[model samples]
Target: MAAAVVLAGLALRFQVPGAYRSPQPWRPEHVMGLVYPAVGAVVLRRRPRLVVAWLVWAIGLLAALQVVLQPLSRWAVAEGATGAAYLRWAAFWIYLLEFLPLITLLPLLYPGGRPPSRRWRPLLWLVCALIAVNVVFAALLPMRYTVGPLRVDNPVGVALVGELAAWRRPMEWLTVAAALGCLASLAVRFRSGGPVERRQIGWLGYVLVAVLLLGCLDMVVATPFALWIVPISLAVAGVPVAIAVAILRYRLYDIDLIVNRTLVYGALAAFTGALYFGLIGAVNLAVSGYGALAGLAGALVVGLTFQPLRLRLQRAVDRLFKVERDPYRLADRLSRTVQQARDPAAALTSALASTRQALGVGGAAVEIGDRDGGVRVHGDGDTADLPQEIPLRWHGATVGRLLLPPGRHDARLAGLLARHLADVAHAVRLTADLQASRERILSTREEERRRLRRDLHDGLGPTLAALALSLDAARLRLSTDPASVSESLASLRERMIATIGDIRELVYGLRPPALDNLGLEGALRALADDLPEPRVDVVVEDADVAGELPAAAEVAAYRIVQEALSNARRHADARQITVRLRRETHGLTLVVADDGVGLPMTADGRVPRAGVGLGSMRERAAELGGSCTIGPRPGGGTEVVARLPLSSARGAPAT
Candidate 1:
């Protein structure tokens, strides 16, 4: 049908008498008529059920049909064929009758291809009735119509042209009312539709607005050349194109961005141009003799003010379009809050609030861990049921998810939020770990203090008291009985030696005396030698045996080895043990393997619960920014491995 319309239009232009001989080379109406129908035809093929597309196609084809028939009708009448002239006239009037529905019903049924509501169905019928009435009046009326340069009598009139002509004014008023009603329905749809629908409506609205503005301009200016007609015709042509774009949803979201930037940049350019010209004129007036300097000063002023003007225009445009959410501003505000926040949880809460405000979304939340029972929410309120979840990641691991209110998913906004919140999430995780470490350190310290107190009270204090009494007795007996003094001296000497042994044992428990003299490697060698039951082998790599390690690292490594050996002897039922230490670029690595029964296992085949010894060893290494691992060796024995950094700056103080 679209091809036929184009062919017929071309045939009429070439063959019809004096019709194709217009002075103007290009006709806007001709182009619009051909283009709108072709566009509609393409769209209709894709969406066969779209009533609006059919109407649009019909409107365009009928317009071109009228243009073609008018000249043919004139040629027929000039050749003295009244019947042929009346037939063409009837066809023209029928095509003209279609205009009412095209304008009134098209907008009402657009996008959805249906009426706005059931109540509007009656109005649609009324519009059809009006078009039928107009067609009937045009057919039966005894009126004579002008076809181009000739006037021909209505050959098939029923002698009712006077009454029909009288009714024309009322029908025109009704047509106007119907068109306004259709526009109102469109406005209602635009108001109620979601973001996607709104954008589709916006495309249509933009063309209508341009046409309306051009109409107003035409009325006010009254140009001799009809300059407003060009833009008005172009806007009419653009209507179908815009509709096709909207319905197809091709780059629909970009329409808003395009409109926003166009308005901003266009306004900025206009304002700057005006300012430049006004400055140049003022400078010219002030320095009439110095035209060059005035021009230079005006250029300088424009160059200096360009950026400020652009920013102001951008803000104005954003406000106008209600696209005021600035991602950078939101990110900056959240960054500052996160930096100043005393706790990670607090920082996350602030970030969620900022995200909600920036995106104009509903309740936002930061949910840590699983979505089920393990979930930890920080937000305005509970967000377990929120549908949208963007993962909050630290390093490469997903530590939590950010839940947002129900709406269209915006990948750009989600990506931006994720990037900004990554640092905060990482900081929160670190803060929690630091707090846990502190608690463990404090608990370990308290336990050590309790052990020291018990040893001092039970062993050293009692022995010291006994020795003092013995010394006093010896001193008193020295003058009274020389024989008693010798016996007192021997008892006091034994008591004193026992108290020194108890004190030495307590000090050894705190930190090995061997470590102070033998260094880490020597200390481990002595420990292996001291073990009486298990055959122990100590291997210190050539690089590490002579290298000096940090004090904290040395202590942590020694304690770890001591704990691992104790665990092996008490739990593994081992007969032999091997300890190895190697030096790397960053730190020292230690490994202890026992040739005994592997780690204790529960009925489920999992490693048994870790005891205090294992926990203390891990904590000691962690305090020095190191790691400890105890697992079954590949060869059926328990292996303990630890890596401690050599630099003091790399470790945090355990106390």
Candidate 2:
């Protein structure tokens, strides 16, 4: 059909006289007729199901027919051809057919090329009936219609041509009604459409509105023929191109951004121009001979106001378009929520929700682990099948994965979301670590309480009870026999002395008394003196080390040294032991080395099960945000080294 239309048009143009066929300014309607169907051909090749493509192609062919037949009929009448009357009638009917679809069906079928609803189908039929009536009356009217410079009579003449002409007014009104109905249908579709569909209609609407405005201007003003024709023509031609672009969704996501920037910048330019002119006029009125100065001042004002005005205009445009899913705005919102959120899980959920809303995807999620450990997911719905997954990293480790539904891929938005999630994940992991550490500290404290209770109840209580009985017996014996009373009194005194030593030992086990009285250095020195067996040495690198250390650091250092010495005495059987305390800029360091057998290790290179003491030492340091390491010394003995950060210790209470 397209080929036939094009060939017919070319043939008719060639057949006209050379004088009448001089080069003419391009006509928008003819250009649209030529190009629209070609675009439709491309669209149809890819999407054969689209009804819009077929309708567009048909419209293009109809336009071509009108352009070809109307001129040829006029040439025939002008030359007084034998069949000129029949030719003119045929052209008249064709002209009616050409415009009927455009005014009645094109808008109704545009975008998706279907009625807005089942109810609208009846409206379609009504438009068709109106077009038919109008065509019939136009054919039967016995009027000599002028075709260009030639007059031709309608072949099928009616006796009541005046009545038919009077009836034509109602038909014309109905055609206008149908055209309005088509526009209404378009509006309905736009209101009910999705993002992609709305964009398609929006592009077409923009072009048509621009053309309409230009036509209105042409009517109102004495515009030069050249001035209105070119722009008006281009705007009309743009309609089909815009439709094709929208249907294909080529750069669809960018359309909103493009339209937003254009509206903002366009309005800004117009406002700035008006302001410049107003300022120039004011300045001329105020100060006559300073036109150049006024122009400079106007330019300065525009430059100063440009950014603020653009921002305001952009926000206004966004509201007009009802755009709610701006990535930058979403990022800002998530950032603020994360900062204020007390719970990491809650923060993650909020962030994912924002992501889903911003991207307009099916769902979104954050999965923290693999299948074996059982995935920990946050966000709405199941995201196992989501197409895109961005890895969230914290401290150079992949903490989790962010999942998003399939659609137009936005790499920039994805990166921003991933970075935001990574921060939240890091905070969540730290919170988990802190909770675990607190639990361990509570457990250790409970164990120490049980141990203390056992010592007081089983050991000290029984001994004290026995001593009281002995004293009672001694008191009874003193009244009867003098020798028995002396022996009993001496034994009771010995028992009482031993009880005092046991109580002191129990108190020392709970906390080093030397640490309370003499600080870390003195406590380590006293510990060395108490160790029995091989010789022991205590070295203090700085005199002010103990004084500068926080109480938690002081206790942690003392306990670590004490535990190392006990371990060496019980397990290592070292010949000699060395306890060293060094003060650094950030913290205090304690190293205890023994010339004894090193730690027992299993085949898998793990410490023996009896190495709970080593773990206890590590826990102590960790509680104060420090570290403890136990390994073999370079000289074939065990070395236990601990570093305690003074700053961390100052923040944390001594355990």
lDDT of 2 by residue, 1-655 (tens): 6656656766676677654442543455576577768877878887798887876777777777666766677667767788988877876776566567765677787877778889999988988888787777778878887755556677788878656576677778878888888888878888999756777777877776787688789999999877777897787667667777888866444555667777888899999999998999999999899999999999999999989998888779877865454777777888987767769878887777666656645468887752113346677643546768899987787878888766675778778878888888766655665665578778998999999999999999999999989888888888788788887888889988999999999988867789888777777777788877767898888886766566667777877887888888988888999888887775778889998989777686655543467767877887988777787899699998898877644465423
TM-score of predicted model 2? 0.54
Please identify model 1 stretches exceeding 4 Å from their true place.
19-29, 74-83, 87-91, 94-98, 135-142, 158-161, 223-230, 265-308, 324-328, 333-418, 421-655
Query: Model 2's lDDT to the true fold?
Result: 0.76
Q: What is the C-alpha lDDT of each candidate?
A: 0.74, 0.76
Highest-lDDT candidate = 2
Each model's TM-score, in the order given?
0.52, 0.54
Question: Which candidate leads in TM-score?
Answer: 2
After best superposition, candidate 2 residue 135: deviation in angstroms?
A: 3.3
